[model samples]
Target: MVRKHLLAIGGALGLGLVSAGLAQTIEGLDLGAIQSRAVEQARDAEAFLSAVSDRGKDARDEARQTVDESLAAVKAIDPTKLPKVGEAGAIDLDEMVSGAQGSLDNPRSAPLFIAFASLSMPEDSLKQMIADVHKAGGVVVFRGLPGNNGRMFAAAMRRVVSQDASGNVAIDPRLFRAFDIKAVPTYVAVSTGFTPCDDFACKSRVPPFDRVTGNVTVQYALESLAQAKGPGAPVAGAALANLVRHD
Candidate 1:
């Protein structure tokens, strides 16, 4: 008889509402005021849960949109367009090979790295910088001016380890705007999407890039990156030190 009364309490009252309905029908209980308040509280709880669910959906949508934008921004280049050798007398044959252990792409990839270098940079400096990035497991993409020396640039690259021959390819102009880069030879540490960046990705907690100039050694810049990666081959003393010591 008591169960029959709760079943009749309009459209499933829920645990809270069911309790209220039972208390309401209790003989001589006179709990009408308390039962009415319970209904309101139950409704409020349901609404709050629904709102939390909606927020989760919105957050997922935001993540999807971000991934799409990053994919659209990525660009590729052909190595055929660049020179495979430097000027007849420009290269120092002895210092060409990087003595660092492992290949150029051997660094830990938690925070993706892509170095934007200019054609205007001196032959020796650019070569050393490229080697450093590679030894530290970063990618190199070259940018040239209206009168840049593509031949010498290509020639210099032939000496260092350029993963996938990307060193011979030109930089995508879109990368400049994405990272807000105003100069060449910028070592931008990016997030997963290769977005141009001055610092480590915010969510990733990686250290940001230190744009290299004549004042600072390229090896130091690369070493800093290896250290930021924490425990890994990039942090190994020999490989990391060799990257800076080779030059």
Candidate 2:
């Protein structure tokens, strides 16, 4: 039954109908919510594995695989709940790219800051930030991390947005490679989509980019990124700083 349903979903996606249904379904699935739930499930699985004494290494590996597959299934449904790539009033990446292509035909808009990490940020903080972005007419896309930290983070985000109705955020790993991230906890504001206005004109202002290490927190790093834009951009700088301090 699950396979059949998945197949139907795939068909829908292929037909471009998935986007229409996605926005409505995504209203309840927020990034923070999903990650929290995934973390809990992973802890439970760990406890179960620890209790299984005398199990061969192969057996344990198989059990872990089963757990992972179950988790993946849960995550698969997330995208459907979000709005399609070009829904009106929604910050659709597709639309952004299209508009960018036209406006930045010469030089692109400022690069978006991309962060890749394995661990989830605090649920309350992350969710609130996501909510703020949504209210500000922005979109967030969460991708799966590589190791335990990644899984836990993915789970937590899943829990927060599972019931979302906007279909604004997404959690997928495929998009990660496209950004060419080097470290687990890294941020890079890219300029891939925006084209320069002309040979000498830039589309959006490019901000300074830097990386931090150890005990890294999402809110703080995001705040720093916003601040890099300059003090005059009160909305981004002030909002991010407030979130970091509060978190």
Candidate 3:
């Protein structure tokens, strides 16, 4: 059984405690949501302090409240640091390779396999997954965590597996916080929709095809996505890709 830890990330001023070294945990916290709410709290607290005079009792009371809220906000998880998702913000996923960019018979725009990886996650394992995903003509998106030394992390990854034909993108760190990711090596299969965007701007939105398939190996991730898009079957991550013809 995977042991999920209770995590508390402190100090947005400096997120030094989180990284590839510590165990990855995303169990019960909607960290991205928490951070957003906290920022709003901190802003409100700051406004209160700026207007209150320090010479009166209101000043002391306001100061105490401000300090408390500030501390909480600074310690809250910053969503800006996670990967960027279509729902959270603007991401031109069309730039990446897709069924439209590739072949039509290959299944709907193909699945977007987003990987939340860190240095702590085994390299050989990740490399194999990358290779398998490419073989299946899937997109491999890498999401780096806070504790990663950018240069060293990429160098390490390159040393293991370098060729990703479908193409890969380093997800916006803030985007990682938006999803309910619980651990490293977690894979999300976006196999049903064309434009990953489901907001008001997108007219061709389908039921959310984004499925977090727990912690799975690379081969399993690809296989699961293919199964998810089958003609009639509707498994969590096992459905067939819902491809459409380009006009």
Q: Please give, for residues 108-210, the per-residue lDDT of candidate 3 as tens digits.
A: 3323445555556666776665555444434444433223232233234334443333144333322244454557776665434442331111123333444
- Candidate 2 global TM-score: 0.35
The estimated TM-scores of all candidates read 0.36, 0.35, 0.39
Which stretch of 10 consecutive residues in model 3 shows the poorest summed lDDT?
Answer: 1-10
Ranking by lDDT: 2, 3, 1
lDDT of 3 at 233: 27
- List the lowest-lDDT window of 10 residues for candidate 1: 11-20
Misplaced by over 4 Å in model 2 are: 1-122, 132-139, 145-158, 162-166, 172-175, 182-186, 192-219, 226-247
lDDT winner, 1 or 2? 2
Distance from true position, residue 114, model 3, in Å?
3.0
Q: Give the true-structure RMSD of model 3.
A: 15.3
* Candidate 2 lDDT by residue in tens digits, 1-247: 2222112111111101012222322432333333334554565345434444355776556555654654554444444444342322322222111111122133323224334443355555555545544433333444432232322332344444322313444332322334444455554444233322221111233333344333445456555656666422344454455444544
